[model samples]
Structures are given as structure tokens and as C-alpha cells.
Target: MNTAGIGGTDATGTSLRRLADALGTEMMWAGARDRPIGEVVIAEPGDVLADLPGALVLAVGARGADAITVVRSAAEAGAAAVAVRAAPGEDGALTPQVKAAAERAGIALMGIAASVRWDRAEADIRGVLERGAADGTSGHRGDLFSLAQTVATLTRGVVSIEDAAHRVLAYSDSGDEADELRRRSILGRTCPEPYLAHLRQWGVYRRARTGEEVVDVEELPEMGARRRMVIGINAAGRPLGTVWVQEGTRGLAGRTEEVMRGAARLAASQLVDHWFQGDPGARLPSRAGLAHGLLTGRFNSGALAAHLGIAPNASATVVAFDLREPESGDAVSQDARRAEAAEIISVHAASYRRSAMVAQACGQVYAMLPERAAAPSSEGLLTRWAEDLVSALRHHLRTPVQAVVAGTAPRLDDIPAVKLRGHHGLQVLARTPERQVATHTALTASLMVRDVLGLLDRHSEIRHPGLDVLARHDDAHGTEMCRSLLLYLDAFGDVGRVAKDLNVHPNTLRYRVRKAVALAGLDLDDPEHRIAAMLQLRLSREEPGTSPFPGG
Candidate 1:
């Protein structure tokens, strides 16, 4: 097959020949092939491109004042793309000129800035050309049947998108390295730094905002054995993810790059299909395929739960989160920086056997903490657990992802209530930016408690004995006494204020409150009992309807 890329071979002579043939220019002075461009390219202003004979002479040097004259001379020579070398301090001003000139001349104005290593560039071009030739038969027919067969034949290993950072999307490898790579990236929750750095340099993430594909790969770190990687973006030019392949030193780098590009395009198509399907459930891998595989019954719950001690009576809370990345913005540098800020939640469920059950559900995990002596009163233990969990997740994931605690756990049956609380917590977090952590304490501590109590009042299952009796007695008497009593309690038992609020006499309001206390089977005289009765009444109020809780 036609595979065109520097597959671990000397391409300098060939690159120089290609450049010479394209421009029909003679080499002025051949510098040492091993010498860095900075040392060889900075002889003198006149000596630079002196013997070269071409209308355009691109001086690919590092960005500096020395390259200014070379760039101007190239433009004056009528070269469509007068690319200059980018130095540490140099700005790629030649790009604009190349674009303008290329537009006018109807030719490509590639910005071959010094940012690219010429040696790598030469190998890349050769590799691309060779692969193109191989893919092309006697005619312009691109035969991919063999390639397709090879891809499907994953006896050695299979490839798929695992994660994407910046424009460097990661691919699952087939060998030991690939397995280790996947384990480290997904299970370890480690940052793909090398990939991220490449994207940042190429401004691929930034360019995605404007709907542009990022095709730069010169800076990718050496993956020990020679590996070629290419990342593709979505239709919106945002990185859908990356594709990588390892084709030993047998001149497969170019072929791998071509394959990755094809994979990226395929991945993009899959993404669009996923969007149209509108099934959020389809976006994640099945838990059956995951490490613990709890969701798919690969792991038995009874034994697992028993082993983890996540029994029916264990107190646990459910939490949920919506993770998203910042939108790519204008300015390539800024965009790339922001694109790097994708949020992913890391759960420690992998570290525990039965706990993985929580990890597989709702994309959220659970922790069966040591039992506390008392259920929380204010910002209870459950709420504190949520806070601590969020803190630990942020630290482990190394990203600032937001999570809300849904509810606490007491047993398996509590899942429904916990899921509901999780949903409520998510809602509260969405509406309350300042309140990043959504614990039951935070919810109970808010004015929304009044609203929450009102909701509970409407639920047939939620029966506050003391509050229900008082309500029933008031209803039977055809008196607005319960409302008055609740108002009085809400106002801290202020009779004058309750009477004024009810537009009635203080004596009348006091009589109603006393009647409520007697009917509710509670003592109005005992402070502690009165407080408990008041809280029960508040919890029994009707609440506005939302979705049924998740687990329920």
C-alpha cells in the first residue's frame, strides 16, 4: 500500500530535493543536517537564501527581527505563501499575508512557521504523499477494502475513542501499552498532559469555535515505539475526540495518521447519530463492560452489597451531577486554553467491590460510611458527606466539576428517596450558583424549606401524625384554626402578631392555637415538644411537583 510518512528514516535529502523541485531553487549553503535551524539559518542577512533562485524564498527561521527581511523578500518575490520561521519571541504575522496573497493568486498560502520542526514536516509530507499513492490504485480509485478489513480484524486489539482533551482525542490500543494507557487514563483519572500540550500549541481547540479542523501533530510526544496520532473535531469544529495507532517502525506512521483521520471522521458521524437518537442513556458505555460491571448483573448485588456492607439498613445518600465543558471562544490561544477545561467526575468506586454498585447507577457513585450515632439535625451527616465527596472528587479528577448531594442512605429502599433528594439537590445547585454543595442541611437551611414542607404535605405517604390530626380537627370543625395555629407557630407563638396577621383578636388566635395543640395530641406548654410539632407541621406542607425521583 502507498504509505507516505517518515517511518524512522532520513528524509532531509529527499525534503531538500522536493523543496528544490517545487521552487526550482538551488541550495545556497547546505548546513549540517543535525544542526538546529537557529544555529545554521542565522549566518547573515545577505548570505540567507543568497544562492537560491526562485521568485519566493521562504526563510523558515525562528520568530525574530532577523526573519522580518526574509519574509518581506519572499512576499516581494511574488510567492503566494511567504511562510517564515517562528522564533520564541516571534509572532506569525506572515500568516495574514499568506492568506491574502493566496486568496488573490488562487493558490494555497500555507503558514510553514518555525513552530513546526522542518525535519518532521518533511517526513509528514513524504508520509502523506506515500499513503495517498498507496490508497490510490492505477487510477484515482482509493481502495479502503483491505484497510477496512484490517480495522475490523481486531484479533490483536480493537480501537475506539476513550477520551478527548483539547484536540488530542485518545484511542484504545490493542496491545499491552494500549491497555495500560486506557487503564491509566480512564481508571486512574489522570490528565493526558502530552495530548493537551499539543492542542494548546496548535490552537486546535481555539480554531474549533470558528468551525476549523486542527491537523497539526508535529509536537506529539514520542510514544516510546513510533506511533502516529491524528485528532478530528465535530461539525461545530469542536474536538469530538482523538484516534491513535501503533504501527511498529515498518513505515506505518503515515498509514496510521491516515487511519486516525478516517476514524475521527467516523467518530464525528457517530456523534451526530447519537445527537439525533436523543437517548442520553446511549452516550455512556454499558456498566456491564466496565471494571465492576454492576449495572449488567455481571456482579451479584447480594454478595457484593454484603461484602461492602451496603445492606438494606445502611444509611447512604445519592448525589447527581451534570458535567460540561466550557464553550470554545474566539482567539486561538484563549480558545485552546478554555477547551482544555473539560469536566469529568472520578468516582472511587473502582477501589471498592460492592460500592461499584453506586458507581454504575445514574453515573453517580455511593459511599457506605461508618454509621453515625444520630441522624443529622441541621447540616446533617448526609449533607456533610456530600460536601466531603465533592471535595474529594474535585481533587482526584483535577477538574472543577460541580456536584449536588441528592439524599442520604439508610438501606436499599432508601434509594428512591435518595434519588429524589439527588434530583432536588441538582435543581438547587442549578438555581443556586453560590450554593455549590447541595446537602440536606443546605436544603433544610433554606427558605425553600417552607416550600418543601408544603410539597410533603401534599404527598399521601408522608404523614406527620401531630400535623395531620390538627389539620383533620380544623377541617371537621369548619374553622380556619389550623392555618391560624401554623401561622402562630411560624411567628414564634406571638399572639398579637398572629391576630393582626389573621385580622382577628389576640384571644381568638390564642384559643385556636390551644385547640390545635390539644387536637394534634401535643403539649403547647412543653417547649421541646412544641418545637417538634412545629417542625412536623412544616414538613407536612404541600410542595410543587417536579419529576419523580430518579431511582424511584
Candidate 2:
């Protein structure tokens, strides 16, 4: 079988001299001098001419019949040229009849040395084709530059590397060879509006974000891109960017497609490195950087305090703000809103006349503020501040905002723990309807239950056997044994009060509680058993639409 074209052009179009040089043999070219050889085919006995079009037909061991007749038949069948094996120490010769037929039909006849193996000749030709495709101008020599240049050289086109946001990161310098849109993209640092619109219509960005490897685009004359190929770059399962190549005079070859795949991998590494290095001002420590460092355990309270200029005895509170965005907004619009909300919260925190460090992380805004001595209580001050901030933000953005204020951390070392508690409070508030603000001190039970639930979720095998039995009983039999027991414990086993809340007689409540303890194998007399059971019940009731204890 013939090898596929390597460069964007046909292998048959290669010069006869180039093919002979690759094979390291002397050849006499006769008849049809410059015609391209589309393929190399080994000749067989009967009527091989039918399969000979655009082929370099190889004739070996042809001493049986008239070789001139085979050459004339091949030329008639549109074979580009014929390569015949020469006898020992002699140049291969064609009769006048064969040369006349070749000259009439524009087919070149060549002779190969007898010592050269046929398989070696075919391998050499394939290598020549592959190398020709990879060779290009020396200007594209660096890592990214070479990639861009190699892509262009392979496809005979222009290339651009762009972030997910369509910001142009790099582009091949094709000089006058590039089209107007290509030049505009490089100069404006982004794809032009017309071209971007076309890409949007084609769902290019959507495909890129979803980790699609390559997207081929059809001709869009309005955008001046005839045919385009987009290769998405990704890192750690997230989209990094894309490499887009616009076709030049021809479509991309198989070799060019392979090169683009390699380029995408290289682009992913470059993008990850850029993210780690961050932007221009990233070297200087900033509030977000400090907060992130503390959250990830890269820094401690002492370093944070020294940077914020807080006193040793100062009281600090960690507050987190979770902004709600419109459900219909796209990712880009949602990001813009998040940035705006973060900026507003940071400005408000700075206005408190105390040392404040504000940061945004995990899709929420966090602020650590040192309380003034004159404040009535750290919780009271933070509550008032959070309420005011919420109202201002709601009025400005016309969206709901939730805020959580953690308990005061008296020592600098306690700030990280305080921040975690604030996050817990925020999560609890998220589940509660129409209740935006929460304080760590007030939601202690809910936070504790939430933490226990999280642990149980991750390590289900560690669940309390008694709680599991009771939960399964409630789920299967529609019984209120778990609810009654939880309320009984919450009311401190006050028979009268617990009965009133459960809407049952005191004796009846006691009997149900005894049944629950027996069925779940719980020793209610043990304080640890009571606490664990109470926490499990609370988690079950925390689900949406769950009814509270019947009365109080």
C-alpha cells in the first residue's frame, strides 16, 4: 500500500531527483520528466495496469516477456513513472517503442541499481516525505514559537494560542502571509468580534470547556477563515486554553493533526506554570494571598498578625460572605458579579477603623477584623457590621447575601479554627430558608451536628449502630421513635414538657422512648449514647421540609 501524504501536499508531487537521492541510487529519467509520483506500487503479472494510475510502478524479474509492452500499458493507464531493475553492472534500458509510448503519454521511466532492495527504496521515500513535512522557516525555533511555526509549516496556515476567555496568548508571525483577521487578533490581543461570533455560533467555547480535544470548523468567509481546527488545552481536568489554526491554501494533513495534539499538551504545561507564577503584583504579599496561605496551612497566625499590625492582646473575628448569583447567568457574568461583590465587601471592611484583612476564596468573601476596645462585645459588633453590609450589598446588587460571623478568637493562633467555624455557620445558614445571618455562638448545636454528619458521610462504617437502627426503623415503619427520643433528650427528659411537645401523654412519651431504646440497642442512661443519638436525630431533621417536634 502507498504511504499517506505527510506534508499538506501529495507525495507523488515530489521531484524524481529527490526520490532517487533518498534511495541512494543512480537513475535515468526518460519520458514525462517532471510529473509527480502519487504512489509506489510493485508490478505483478496480469493486467496490473488497472491499479497503476498515479503510481511509480516497480518492475523486477521482468526477463520473461517484452518489458516494453508493460511500460506502454502503464503509461496508457496513467502511471506517473516506471522504475525498472537494472541487470548486474549495467544501466537499465527501455526499447524505442517504450520510450515513444512514454513520451506520448507523459510518463517518466527510471532505472534502479540491482543492489538496492525494493523494501529499502520504499522506506527511504517515506522518510523523505515525513521530514519534508516537518521542515520550515528557522524563525519558529523557541518552545512556543516553534510550535506555532511548526503548525503553520505543516498546514501551510496561521496559528493562535488563546485562553478560555478568547484572549490571545500567542500567535504565529506570518507577516504578509496572514489574513486580515489573523493580524487583527494579534494586534488587539483577542479574536475580533466577527470571528468570535462565528465561534460562538459553532459552540467552540462550550466544547473547549467540556474538554473536547479537537473541533473542526467549516468555511466562514465573513470571518476570513476558510477552514479552522481548534485543539483544547486542559490541566488537572480543568480547561486551560486552546490552539487554533486557520487553513492556508489547503486542508491539514495527518502529520499536521498529530503536531496540533502535541502542541496542546505543551500549551497545558505553559498555562499551569503561568497560574503558579501568578500575575505581576503576585510577588508582594496581599490580603487574599495571606488568607489563602492560612487556609491551606502555608502560613501561621504569627505571620498574619505581623503583616496586619495587630496587637498581641487584640480580639479577632472571622466573617464569611456567600453571595448568591442569578441561576440563568453564564459563567463569565457570574465571575464578574463575584468580583464586584468581593470588592464591595473588602471596601466596607476597611472602613471599620480597625485592622482588617479581606480575601476571596472558595467562591466566598472572608474578612478577619480586630475588634476595637470600645465595642460592646465581639459578637455584637460583628453582627451589626454584617447586617449593615448585607443591607448595602442587597440594595446595590439586588441579590440575596448571606453572612456568617465566627466567635471571637482571643489569641492569634486561634484565627484559623475560628475561620473554619465561620464556614460551618455559613453552611448551616445556607440550608435554612430566609435566614441569612448566623453567629458561631448561636448555632453551636447545628454546627456540631453538621460536623458529625460530615464525618459520617465520609466514613459511613463509623456510624453509630444504634442511630442506624433507629433511622432505618423510622424510614421503614413511619415511626416517630427517633423524633420522640431526640425531643426527650433536648427537653432534658422532662416527661411533661417532652409529652407536650410531642402532642402525647407523658406516660405515652415515656413508653415510646423505652421502645426506641430497646429496639435500637441504646442505653439512654449513658451520657455518650444520649449525645450521639441526639446528634443523629438533629441531622435527619435538618433536611428540607422536615417537621419540627410536634409542639415546643
Please give the lDDT score at residue 510 for candidate 1.
Answer: 79
Distance (Å) between predicted and true CA of 516, model 2? 3.2
Give each prediction's root-mean-square deviation over alpha carbons: 19.4, 20.4
Candidate 1: lDDT of 22? 42
Tens digits of per-residue lDDT for model 1, 89-158 = 4454444443344345432233443446543443333333334334321111011212222332221233
Candidate 2 lDDT over residue span 385-479, tens digit each: 78877876676567888888877676656767777777767767766637668888888876665667677656756667877788899899998
lDDT of each: 0.40, 0.64
What is the lDDT for 533 in model 1?
Answer: 64
- Candidate 1, poorest ten consecutive residues by summed lDDT: 31-40
For model 2, name the residue pairs that clash.
Answer: 12-37, 12-38
